[model samples]
Target: MDLVRIGDKVISRHKIDSFLTEILQLRSMGLSQTDVAARLGIDRTLVSRLENMGELRKGKSVAVIGFPIANRDEIYALMQAEGVDYVMLMSESERWDFVRQKSGIELFNAIMELIALAHSYDQVVVIGSGKRIKIIRAALDKEVVGLEIGESPIQEDKYVDPAELVAVIRAIKGGNV
Candidate 1:
């Protein structure tokens, strides 16, 4: 990598590339075009053009992942009505059985698969406790809308309001939540 010197300052192509990559990543993570441009000392139009140029997937797709849901049927039905693309809902026993059924490698692969599937969607709706919600958000590292049912070490299913979840999903899908 050759560093170009201008007066007392040095400019690097690698550094520029890294900066652009960071800006693009931030945009992908849901930053506004104007914010990204301001952060990087670039034009907002350029940011918009860059995003349009890089878009590989179009439209908003949503994925819902939850466990130990008390109103599973109601929530699932509402999600179905909302036209959710991917839905993964499990009870406590079902979650235990799922984990116990998989070996180490299988579990790892399954987790990766889930992550990959979640990444494909524009938004991921996670329904779980606070701790698990944070973990999912960090793992997905995208636009995650968490539905906190309760705290960790959960012993009972949390009752969810279907209408409330639908409204939240609607807001998220509309890019307001």
Candidate 2:
């Protein structure tokens, strides 16, 4: 008698199953396979195979990547709604490394470029948190060209209200603020 044991499997098919379900859910909800790949940071071929397997659920727009971590679309959408056109997402370590390699001037220039991209918008919103937020706030205060840093010099006093930031950008560009 020959018996097949699931435990004999080399790879974790469950993970594959999970990935498939997630991809299918995203696809049915109107996300293309390429979009799924971009959000998941994986190849489109993997998503294609999973869709073919029929291991996916019918309709689920959002896939929870290991609980707290979600794909990029949610983050991007949230930023957009918040009126933030200049969104910089980097790790704390990366922020520190950037500051170390480039003088505040160079970093300031790069940030201005990001803000300038929002010319079509009425205002530019910069979304950040933690050390990243602090660094961005500081760069803005230095008159980063496109941004209107708050009147307060103190970091605590410097807050980024999406609406306020937009107002300031409009004023500056329109020569009102």
How many pairs of residues collide in model 1? 0
lDDT of 2 by residue, 1-177 (tens): 233347765566677668767877788678999999999899999888865653323221111100011223454444455444445434335545666887789988865775444333333334333444355436444222233333323233222344554454444444333
Candidate whose TM-score is highest? 1
Each prediction's TM-score versus the true structure: 0.65, 0.24
Residue ranges of candidate 2 with Cα displaced over 4 Å: 1-74, 77-86, 118-120, 128-177
- Candidate 2 achieves a global lDDT of 0.47
Model 2: C-alpha RMSD to truth?
19.0
Clashing pairs in 1: none
- Scored against the true structure, residue 84 in model 1 reaches a CA lDDT of 89
- As a TM-score, model 2 comes out at 0.24
